[model samples]
Target: MADPKPALVLHLATGGEPLLFALTTEESGKLAGKLTQLVKAGAVETVTTKDHQEVAINFAHVAAAYLDDLTRKTTVFGMR
Candidate 1:
């Protein structure tokens, strides 16, 4: 059988650049809850973007991180 995991999209603070990766739904939930703690706990050292760009994660940078929900629905007039 094929992998049933869904993609969890990460939107970087840098110019709203989006990074896509596959993660199990369970991991996604854990990530959602641990995002702030993970940032504050000094566990993560660096973040790698999809474009092969690397970013250093510091207290100040992670302080700006937050969970957000995005949708791509079309309307009668146009895209919102």
Candidate 2:
């Protein structure tokens, strides 16, 4: 089966550069909730990407967070 994981897109308040993190839908949802809480608490957190890169993000600067529905490849079974 092909990978169907969508990317978590974080739009910064700066309005120009957006951060992309490859994650499953469920993980993205959970992360979104955590981000919301952190934003309310005014915290800066570090998140590890799928590639194992650590990124420090200030919740206050996060304008928006959503999952990017990337194109998926259809997998055919019982076919060469």
Candidate 3:
């Protein structure tokens, strides 16, 4: 079989400086495109895993960031 798809997680800093982002392996590009779109829209900063298997878009400045983090946390881990 082909290499397994890498997981992913997106973390956006909230209530603090030096913005933060946490991502896991299950939340890859294909899984988190909508968030990526938001990143592209200038709503957040996007940070993909080294292998491109995961993606984390920072949206602390946006209200939705907190919501997204909560939803995604149940699915993806904070780290690999």
Candidate 4:
């Protein structure tokens, strides 16, 4: 087996379920950049989720964002 691919997760300051986007790393980075710009400009934008749901995101309320990789298994002392 191999490690799973990463996903982009966004959380709002209002406190609710985190939004997870199953996008490629490049796509994730691009979205993140867009959010940053929106936040700086104090704007709101709509984005589609993995389930094809349209979500309106208020950048001002975005508490934090990050790329999450489930986990990476490593060995210690040359053992699995």
Off by over 4 Å in 1: 1-6, 39-80
Global lDDT for candidate 1? 0.46
Q: What is the per-residue lDDT of model 3 for residues 1-80, given as tens digits with 9 covering 90 to 100?
A: 44443433333335343333334445444346566456456554545543544333445444333212423323442242
- TM-score leaderboard ranking: 2, 4, 1, 3
Q: How close is candidate 2 to the true structure, as a TM-score?
A: 0.61
Give the higher-TM-score candidate: 3 or 4: 4
Off by over 4 Å in 3: 5-24, 29-33, 51-80
> What is the lDDT of every predicted structure here?
0.46, 0.66, 0.41, 0.63
Give candidate 4 regions above 4 Å deviation: 1-6, 14-30, 70-80
Cα RMSD for predicted model 1: 7.6
TM-score: which candidate is best? 2
Give per-residue CA lDDT, model 2, range 20-73, as digits (tens). 788656666667667667766657877766676777877787777655544555
Question: For candidate 3, what is the TM-score?
Answer: 0.24
- Which of 3 and 4 is ahead in lDDT? 4
In model 4, which range of ten residues has the least summed lDDT?
A: 71-80
Alpha-carbon lDDT of model 2:
0.66
In model 4, the Cα lDDT at residue 61 comes to 74
lDDT order, best first, reads 2, 4, 1, 3
